[model samples]
Target: MTTKSITIKSDRTIKSIMPPTKGEILCKVSGHPKLFLRVNASGAKLWLYRYTHPVMKSKHKLSLGSYPAVTLAHATAMRLEYEQLLQQGIDPKAHREQQIKDEHKSLASTFEKVAWHHFEQLKNKQKATTLKRKHGRYELLCSYLGDTPIGDIEPLQMLEVLRDIQANSLKDDGTPTDKADRCAVIASDIFNHAIVHGYATNDPARIVKPMLDSYRYGNRPSITTPSEFGQLMRDVETLKGTVHDSVFHSIKLLSLLFIRNGDLRRLRWSDVNLDMAQIDLQPMKGHGASKLRMVKDMIVPLSRQAVEILKAQQAITGHTDYVFHSDTATKNNIINENAANDALKSLGYQGTHCAHGFRASARTMLRHKLKYDKDVIEMALGHITRDPNGTAYDRWEFVEERSQMMQEWSDYIDNLKTGKTDNVIKMPRMRQNDIKTV
Candidate 1:
């Protein structure tokens, strides 16, 4: 017996169709050529479109959607769209697949997603503090272009975000121009990362550089003159009023050690070897021009003055692991990061002298005044200076020279502090012919 094909009339008629005994049955829809209601053995009614590819001249089946979910009227509209694509010499199946692929590509290329991928690459290589700062800048960028595709963001969009940061981020006196510049730099790095990884084609942030405020170049505020530095040392020795004694000692050690503020604050008693007269500092990751590969502990040859200060500090904070232990509850029980600087400000050295100025002071005097080797002084400052042959100095290079220099430096500062050094080095006077008369 032959089964007759019935035209689907309404939603009720479509739902009333019985499943075939073994396979699926396709009931044709009236007034629609290729559209039909498919009733499967499992009792699911679906819409199918039977078509011939214009290019291949072969038949193809396309599932529009399940029936009831996609009504007869909706299936008719879809069939019309497929017919339009056929008339344009396109395969409906290939077109739909291309659309899905494009959508996935777009999602993967979004600014937020791509930036996060770039950050993951950096999180392993950078220090924890450096990563924290970068994460903060990334969050700000995401606030503006989180959902935007990385390739779609233009240079103007990046500039707008930077302008907003420049205007909104305030310091005590004015806008933080340095922070705005940093944001631009970080955005450029992210875009570069995206370009390398195929998430973007161009760096929008690179073009925004000319639009940012020009950074003013000047020396870091420091008491480089010997007499001023000597007086600053004396003031630090007798520092009183409003500054905690622990903070005072921290500032003293900072001047004597001339290490970075973070390094000093995070100094552990375990890292100090008074008998060896050395500080085996771990590789500190932050802003610096040193090209030394951080493969091992940084050796800081301690001066007798530095060792004595540590011995005294051991009398107070020796029980704790950190040399600069915090009195109150806090993370790591280390002293506050700004304690040394705040003590400097309280000593009336706010703009003229800073905690970092100690490095500058030691670097200048050790090089010019005391006539120490430049490479040894740079090594003492933890900077990677190149040798005469243009090779980068190793971390442990000039160990004995640095040790002697550290001793002489401490003794020189002692002479200056006690006003016993009358042989202060003077800047060479310019000759009459060498001076340009305006």
Candidate 2:
């Protein structure tokens, strides 16, 4: 005799059903036609959805879940979803497998993983100091979004993370808006990398600018006037007690060269051509594509005074590759970037003067006091300026004129140091014909 099949009404009804003597028993759920509760001879109950693919025309069985774990209501809902997929001519089993694979991919392609890849690309392109700062920013990003899937990040979520960074990352003055701005930029770059590598679809950090506080551009504190700068020089000359001779010379060269602190710290003996009276420099700033793309070899004409400073330094660090080798073995081989600024602080010029401020001091005095060609002055400071015709001026152009200008500038500084204020050299006038019309 054949037994009739029972329709499953609820959980208790499912529990009361008896297993088949030989194999398994299939009980149909009342509202879900394709959904069934299968009970094996050992009473192991499971939910299954059986259907035929409209396109493939083949019977397929998809396991919704085990019984009790997946209640009758959940199994019904899952069956309905699979039935909809079949109606749309999609293979439900294949679709479910693809979903599992996508989830695994998302777990592996996390924000921190992509960020490290992006940082590796910058190691050779960016300066050491800049790389250090960017690494700190990356750590901050990882703290909040490290494990999150890059593709799953949303704009609002990015804004929330950035806002937290802004609010928490405070200096003595207050929150550093620049930190927030920089973090946002770094996050955007990571997302851009993710998109290129197929790990993400959109850059959520791109649109987060409007959510951050505005940052004001402030000039570095500097002694702009010649009188104050002269006093600063005299103070530097008389710097006494505990200051290393190498550091003192580094300060003097920084004053004369006005190069970035990073470039100054990384200076090498090979970069200086004392016999030729020129210093070949590769500035740390403006060397990358994002900032200015002005990364090229720069030539600085050395003054007799500047050349003498290098000659004296040779007595100490000439044996080493770096011009400013560190005294301690635990530290970097070269002088730390903050050594010059710290020396200034020792001389009571902490907030008023900095190592980088020398650039400003030279730029201002070169324009107002020395009366040098603006273009030549800028080139002397390793700045990239353009001609009136919109063409970038060659970095090595006007080498002769710049050499003379450097010599005269050194002489002017000498006069200031000797307190011979009255013996100012009359700057040669630029010929009217030599001046280009804008």
lDDT of 1: 0.78
Q: Would you estimate the TM-scores of all the predictions?
A: 0.58, 0.76
The digit string of per-residue lDDT tens for model 1 on 1-438 reads 124387887877887788887678879888889988888788888898999999999999999999789998899999999999999999999998998987888799898888888889987687566788889888888888899988889988889988888888756566454677787888888889889977789988889877876543234578887888889999988774457656777887777778788788888999999999999886565442342423235689988998888888898899999888887734568877767877788778888989888988988887678876565665676765555556665667667767777777788888889886565433332111121111
Runs in model 1 lying further than 4 Å from the true structure? 1-81, 87-136, 139-147, 151-219, 238-246, 282-288, 292-299, 325-333, 384-404, 418-438
Q: Distance (Å) between predicted and true CA of 204, model 1?
A: 7.4
State candidate 2's TM-score: 0.76
lDDT of 1 at 422: 64
Residue-by-residue lDDT tens digits, candidate 2, 63-154: 98898899888998888888898889899999999999999888878999999999999987876778998999999999999999999999
